[model samples]
Target: MLDVLKPVTSLKLSTKPRGEGAVFKLHYRATFVFIMGCCILVTATQYIGDPIECLPDKDSIPQKVIDTYCYITSTYTLPKYYNMKVGVEVPHWGLGPEMAEDEKVYHNYYIWVPYMLFIQAISFYVPHWIWKAIQTDKVYTILMGLDNRSLDEAEKKDKENLLVKYLALHLHTHNVWAVKYIVCEILNFVNVLVQISITNAFLGGEFTNYGPKVASFLWQDPEDRTDPMYEVFPRVTKCKFWKYGPSGTVQKHDALCVLALNIINEKIYVILWFWLIILSVISALALLYRVLTMVSPSFRARILRQHGGTLRPSPLDPSARDAVDSLVHRCQYGDWYLLHSLGRSMNNLTFLDVLRALDRELNRSHSSDYDLNEKNLLKGKDVTSV
Candidate 1:
C-alpha cells in the first residue's frame, strides 16, 4: 500500500479559518488513531497471511510447532502461573457425533490454535517496530494544521525533504504497535485457556476423543484423583468437575494462575456472556468499519474533522461523492492519489494551522510583490520551535 505524497496543499476549505494549534491537534489524533487501527488490522491478519514482513523475534518463541507447544504449555500454563488450562476441557457441542468418529481432532485444534495465533501476533510485533523509523517530527510539520491550500507551498509546508520521502510511502507499520499487539495475543491466548478450564470445571464436559486417553493416564495416578477433570490448580477453588489436582503442591501452577483462577470454572463463560463476546464484537466492527472506509468511496466519514481553521468542513472530499456513485461509470479510482491529497493536506492544515495566521500576516505585510511569491511572504512550517 504505497501512499502517494502530495506537495502538501490541495485540501478542502472551511468557512472560518482556525489557528495553527488547532490543526496540530487534529493531525496528531488522526496520525495516532490511524496508525493504531491499521496495526491492529494488519497484525491480526499476519498469521492469516498479509505480509507487513516479519521482524526478528526477540521473544525466542520457537520455530518448531511442537516446541512452541512445549514453551507455552510449560511456561505459560494455568497451574504454572496461577490456575490455567490449555485446550478444550469441555465437550464439543459444536462438533456433535463427528467428535466420536475421530478423537484426535481435538488434539489437532489444540496444536493449531496457539501456533497460528502466536505466529500472527508476533508477525505484527516486528513490522510495527519498523514503522516507527518514519520521521514523525517532519510528519508533524505536515499534519499540524493544513486546511486551506491557499498558502504558498514554501510557507505552508517545507518541500518534501529526505524525511518525508523516506517515510510517506512505507508499507510496514510501527514497533510500539507490535508490542501492544503481542500483549493482546498473550491476553487472548490466556483468556481462551481460562475459558476452557472454567468450562471443564463447572460444566463437567468431557475432552471428547482425548477423554479416554487422557483419562486413562489420570487413572494411573497415585492419588484417588485420576480424572483429567481433577488436574486443577491447587489453593484455588476446585470446581466439582476436577478431582485430580494437578498431582499436588510442587506440581502446582505458576503465578498467572491467580488471575487465571478468577477466570476459570464457570466464571469465564459467564464473563464471555457478560462482556468479552460483546467487546470482541465491537472490536470486530471497528475493524470492519476501517476496512469499508478503505474500499468504499461511498462510505465517507460521517463526521470528518477540520485540519484548517474552518468550523464547517472537516478533512474529507465529499465533492468526489457523485464521481464514485456508479461502479461502471468510474475511471480507474486512484486510492493512493486521493489518500495523499487528503492525508498530506490534513497533515499541514490541521496540524499546522496555516490559514488564520496567514490572514493576519497578509494584512500586516507591506511588500513589493502582491502575492505569496514575494521574498518576505509569511511562512509557518517550523513546529519544533513552536
Candidate 2:
C-alpha cells in the first residue's frame, strides 16, 4: 500500500517554477493527491479485508451463502431504533424488528466509494489541466533560462535584452491569455461547489452537514450524545434473505451484518467535508484578489511595485515613479500578469531591471510612431502649398 502511494506523494512534492498561485496549487496538487490517496486506501481495504460479515439465525443456511447474498443484495438499518438500548430493545443501534412502518435505510453506497473518490481526484485536477493547455509554456519560452542565477552575466544580459524586445513588440497582446487564466481560477471555485453538491447527493444528503454534526457530537457530554458517524455510516445493519423450508413453504431469514468498512469511510468523509469547506473559502478569497487587481489600477501598481521591491518606505525617484505609473496605465491586464509571473521566477534586482528596460523600449516605440506621424503631416502640408 505504501509502495502504491509513493509516486503520488512524490508528485505532490515535486518542485517547479511558480506558474500558479498557492491556492491554485492547493486545488490541483495537494487536494488531488490527498483524494487519490484516500481512493487507494479505501480500495485496498475493500479488496484485502472482510468488508461485510453476516450471521444468520438458521443453522441450515450456509454462512458463505448468507454473507455473499447480504453483501451483494444490500444491507439496511432501521433509523428509528438508533437511540434504543443496545441489549434490551434492539440487537444493535440500527438493527431491529422488521416492521412495515419502520424505515429501511440501505447501505449500498459504500461499495462505490473508492470509485467515487477516484472520479473526484480527477475532477480536482481538471482546472489545472485546462490552465496548462491555455498557458502553453509561454512564460517558460519567454524566460529562456534567465531565471537561473548560475548563468554568466553576459548570457543573462543577452537573454534580458531579447525578453525586453519581445515585451515591447507584444504590448497589450496578453489580455486574452490573462483572462483565460482567470477563468481557470474561477473554474476552480466552481469545481469545489459542484463537487460538494454531487457528494452530498451521493451520500443521500448526509455529507453536507457531516462535519458540523461531528463537531457538535464531539462537544456534547458523552453520556447524552449519539454518534453522528453511526447515523451517517452505521457499523451494523440488517439483511433479509428468503429460503424454502422442508415443507416447501417460503421462510424469511434475517441476518445481522457488520460493516467494518464504515470505520474507514466515516473518517475519510469527515476529512473531505472539512477540507472542501476550507478550499471554498480560500478559493473565494483568491478570486477576490484577482478581481481587485483587475479593476483597480492603483492596486495593480502597488502589486507591481511590491513585486519589484520598490514599495519600501524609501520612495522612488520622481522620474522612476512616473515611469512605473505610466507603464501600469499603458499596459493591459495580460501584460501585468505576464510580468508578475516573470517577477516570481527572476531575482528582485533582475526583475526590476527587466521592468525598466521594457518601459524604455515601450517609450522608444511610442516616440518613433509620433515622429513618423509628424513627418507625414509635414509632407501633406508641403503638397497643399505646392
Candidate 3:
C-alpha cells in the first residue's frame, strides 16, 4: 500500500523552486582560490627577490687571502649557477674538496616551488568542480521553482502539492544523487590528505617531523645555538670554473651563499601543514555527524521536533508533523543536509517549517473545496425532490 501511495503523497507535497543562494557553494572552492592567490603572489615577487650573498672564509687567513687574490684577479660577480657554466666554487668548511663541474648547484628556488603550489591549488579544486558540475544545475532547477512568493492562496496550495511530490520523488528515486554528493565530500577530505602526503614526500618523511626541529628553534636560547638552524633557498654553496685566467685552467672555489627565501618557505609550509591537518579533522567530523544524523532515528526525531517547535508558536498539526518526520526518516543524511544547508542560507528558518506551512495550506484548500462540493450536491437533491 505504501509503495502505491508514495508517489501520490509526494505529488500532493510538491513545492516550487526556491531562490538561488549558497546551496551549491562549498568551502573547498574558497580554499582553492586562496592557494592560487598565494602561488601568484609568490611568483610575482620573484620568490621575495632575495639574492645569494657569499663572503670570504673568515676563519682561515690563507683561504681569505686566496679569496681576495682570486676576487682581484678574476671578474667579481654575484654567485649564480647556470647549468654547465661554472660560477664561484664554494669550499666545504669542515671536510671535502670544492664542488665539481658535473655537480648540480641548487639555484632553482623560484622555479619548481611556485609551479608546485599552482598544481596543488588545481588539485584542491578538482573535486569541488566535479561536485558542482554534477549537482548545481539540477539543484538550481529544483530550488528555482520555489521562489514564487506572490502567488494567491490557491496557487500556493497547488505549488505545495507539487513540492510534496518532488520531495517524495527525490527521496525514492534520486537517492543516488544524494549518496554521490556525500561521497564527494569524503573525497574532498581525501584530496587534502593526499596533498599533505605529497608535500611530506618532498619534506624528508612526515610533515610533522619538522615540528620538533621548529620547536627546538623556538625555545632554544639564541646564545646557545651559534649557527642558524635552517638553510636559505637557492643555496649556492660552491662554484667551479671550466676555464680560468686564459690558460684554460680548471678552478673550483668553495664559497657560502644563502638566499632569504628559504626561511619564508619553511615558515609558510609548516603553517600550511598544520592548517591542512585541522581542515581534514573538521571535515571528517562533519561527515560523521551527517552519517549519524541520517541513520539514527532518535536524533532525526529530535531534530524534527525541535525544528517544528521553532517553526510554529503553536504545536504543529499531528498529520503534518508526521509527514515532515517521515521526510527526514526516508531521506539520506546528504539529502537532509542539503535542505538544512539551504535553509541555513536563509537564516532563522528550517526546511521542515516550509513543509509544515505548505501542508497546512493544502489542508485548508482541500476543506474549502470539499465544503463547496457538498453544498452543490445538496442543492441538486433539493431540486430533484421539488
Candidate 4:
C-alpha cells in the first residue's frame, strides 16, 4: 500500500514514525503472507491426503489384465525410473498404467509440484532479508536514541535537536548508501522474474514435450484452446510403464495417470504470475521515484516549500530553535534536502513546520530586542533635551 503524497518519495518510505523497526513495506508483507499460505496448503494437501489419483486404462485391457496391475506397485513405479541404475535390467513385471487415455504421465509430478512451490516461497523472502541486513543497524541506533526519555533534560534536548539534524541531512544528502535501497528494489523485481522462469522450466515437462512452453503461451488465447493437450495444467497425462515378461522379455504398457495436484498448481501459478507482474511494476516505479528524489534538489526544495506552507508545527522548545533554524537554512539554500525517514512520525511535513515555526519565533525575539533598545534611546534623548 504505497500511497503517493505529492511524489516527494516512494510510498514505501513514508516519513511517518511507526513505533517499530521494519525493513519491509506493506506490499512485501502482503506478498510474503500469500506465498507462505500457498506453501502450507500444498504441503498439507500432499502429506495429509492423496497427492495424485490414478485411473486404470479399461478400454485397451481385459478385466483379468487390469486385475493383475496393483495400485501399491504402481505407486512405487515413478521413483524406480527416477532412481534407475546405469546398467541394471528392467524389472521382470509391469506395474501397469493407472490413468485413463486423456490423461498423460507426469513422471514424478507429485514430488516436483510441492518442491517447486516450497522453493518459490523461500525465494520471495530473500530480498526482504537483504534489506533488513542493510537497514536495521542504522535505523535502530537513531530510533533508540530518539525514543530514550530518561536522559538529563538539557542533554536530552540537545540530543533530540541533533537527531533531527541528522535525519534532515540524511534526507537531503544523496549518497552511495541511499542507492542501496534502490538496489534492493531492483533485486526484488529480478527475483520475481527469475522465480517465474525457474518454475516454468521445472514444470514445463508436465505440460509439453519440447522444453518450456510458457514463453509461447504468454499471449496465447486461453479461450481458443479447448484440447487438454494445450492446457498449462493438464489434469490427464498418458503414463507408460514397463512390464517385464519371462526370460528378459519386457512388455511396455501405455495408460493415463491423473495429476490431482495439477489442479492446485494451475490455480496457484496463475495467481502468482499475475501477482509478480504487479509487484514488479510497483517496485520499478518505487525505485525510479526514489532515484529521482536523490538527483533533483530543486524537486526536493519545491516539496519542502509546499510542506512548509501547508503543515502546522508541533509544540516547540525555544532552546532548540537555533539548531532547527540551521537545518532550515541548509535546505533553503539547496545545500541539503530533507527526506522522509519511513518512520511513521518522521516526514517532510513535520520537519518543514518545525522550521517555519522556528523562523517565526526568532523574528519575534529580534523584534522585541529592537523595540526595547529604541524606547530606551528615546527616553535618554528627551531627558538630555530637558
Per-candidate TM equals 0.26, 0.93, 0.63, 0.56
lDDT for every model? 0.31, 0.86, 0.52, 0.50
What candidate 2 gets wrong by more than 4 Å, as runs, is 12-18, 46-48, 87-89, 308-322
| Model 2, position 119: C-alpha lDDT score | 96
Error of 2 at 245 (Å): 2.4
RMSD of each: 20.5, 2.4, 14.0, 13.2
Which portions of model 3 miss their true places by more than 4 Å?
A: 1-27, 50-110, 145-162, 225-241, 303-323, 330-338, 347-352, 357-386
Tens-digit per-residue lDDT, 62-132, candidate 2: 88899899988888998788888777888788887778888888988888898999999999999988888
Error of 3 at 7 (Å): 50
Model 4 C-alpha lDDT per residue in residues 1-118, reported as the tens digit of each score = 1121122222243332322213235344667666656655665553444554544544445433533342223333232222223234322112322334332223344455656666
- The true-versus-predicted C-alpha distance at residue 110 of model 4, in Å, is 5.7
With a 3 Å backbone cut-off (N, CA, C), the pairs that clash in candidate 2 are none
- The candidate that wins on lDDT is 2
lDDT of 4: 0.50
Give Cα distance to truth, residue 283, candidate 1, Å.
3.5
Winning candidate number (TM-score): 2
Per-residue accuracy of model 1 over 98-135 as CA lDDT, tens digit each: 22233311111222322332333343233223323332
Model 4 residue 268 CA deviation (Å) reads 0.4
lDDT, model 2, position 171: 89
